[model samples]
Target: MPTLDPTQLETLVVIAEEGTFDAAARRLHITPSAVSQRIRALERAAGQVLVRRTTPCTPTEAGEPLIRQGRQLRLLLAEAAATLKTGDTDDTVVDLSVVVNADTLATWFRPVLDEVATWDRTALRITVEDQGYSADALRRGEVLAAVTSEPKPVQGCTVEPLGRLRYTPGATPALVERYRKGRGIDWSAMPMIVYNEKDHLQDEVLAAHRATRPPVVHRVPSSHDFHEAIRRGLGWGMLLDAQAEADLASRTTIPLPGAKPIDIQLFWQRWRLDSIALDDLSEAVRRAARSGLRPTRPL
Candidate 1:
């Protein structure tokens, strides 16, 4: 079995996260050439090609697994070091890594920091991912907890039911009139805004009705920008109800037929170990979810 090289994995993780050799080198406080050489050496040591040296570099399949593990390893090491330091008189803080979706991050997620003002001794390190993808980070052990759309538990992680976040298909009245023209959804011909290629809600809505995929797909990556784009009549998109409610009430927005509601159930998945920081965060998140989310039937 090959022994893991912490330095090499660490370098790869940094490069993947930062997306540039020079940026990663600066982050590591090393020269660009040294960074490049180290990465090359790491690829050799692992006996696998890792990062692709392209613009806004991307990791190969082999690279992703190790890079994720590297982040988790660093977090665990930090926790262990903190535990050891706590034996001394010096004050120590535990570093906890967490994953969360961007929309929830933009919505009810950040309040946990202020909500847990009591836990001054601990510091949380967060990694933001999409709700649809955050669960993968939990499976990889890249984070202790995640705000995810998946209710299923990852191996060795305990699952806790949070609540549902509802998204609705909404569009501005002017945009609706122009596009619909007193008509209805046309799968192939309509222009639609989507949350990148990974987002399939719009396509799913059309397909469920046996419609063809829209030829003109406008990609808006940010949740905020996506809402703005739809409101501006640029395209139709699935907007969170909380985001579009005001517009809907003011007659600024309209929901498309056959696309009344799209609900995304979110869950809390975390390590089974008893950690004060984790417990506190979980409680706050659950409370927020219950307050805002639609009451769910057992799932």
Candidate 2:
């Protein structure tokens, strides 16, 4: 079996995180030339092009396992330090990078993170992506875990049902008035709000209503702004139930009739490892989801 040099493996992981040889060298407190040499030697030992020479460098298929190994080693070292009561400082804190969707970030995800705050030895680095594409971040090794809509686990990750987030078609009273004035909502001609180009909820709602044409979508990427846009009558869009709470009570927004709300089933995807921090964080998230979301229904 081929053995990887520890220094070379660490170099690969740092380069992947820092995105360039110079940046990796700066992080490791070495010359950029030394970083290059270490990577070259590592590639020779592996007998493959481990790192793709891109603008912001990325790992090849052969490099992923080594990168993961490097991460695992760091975690183990942190665990050992914590166990030994050694002179480990805050520098030993584990940084857990996770990907989550915008809606979750705005609503239920915050309270879950409060649990993570109790772990003084760990810090979370969060990446926001659409629920539909979050698993791709995990597959690419960009994050340690993710909240994704996909039930299928990524290559080395374990997946479990979190719960469902319901989204209802919502519009301002003014927009509703306009919609009701017509014989029916001319959805194709009406202005609509969407999170971004990647958002499909609006189109799905339109399809469910049998509206054949696409609307003039107003893209509001920020979650707060997206809600505000609809609240201010920019366009009609689906609002997550939690978000719709205030609007529903105030009668500022009304649900469009004849359309069933979209219930997005979410799942937790994380590495199938026995790290204490990961385990604790996952349990906290699961607990929060159980309390905040609808239970996942059996198919």
Deviation (Å) of 6 in candidate 2? 2.9
Mind giving the per-residue lDDT tens digits that candidate 1 earns over 1-299? 46778887888888877889999999999988988888888788778888998988878877867776676666556556666666662465655678887677667665676676666557777887877888887765457788887878887678877777788877777766665634575556668898776787777787776877767889888878888898888878888876788887887778875566777888898877655556777888788877767777674
Q: How many clashes in candidate 2?
A: 0
- What lDDT tens digits, residue by residue, belong to model 2 across residues 1-299? 58889889889989999999999999999999999999999999999999998979999998887887777677666766776765655356787889999999998888778888887778799999999999988877778899999999998899999999999888887887776634556676668888988899888977876775444678999998898898999988888898888887888988875667889999999988778888888988998898888889898
Q: Considering only N, C-alpha and C atoms within 3 Å, which residue pairs clash in candidate 2? A: none
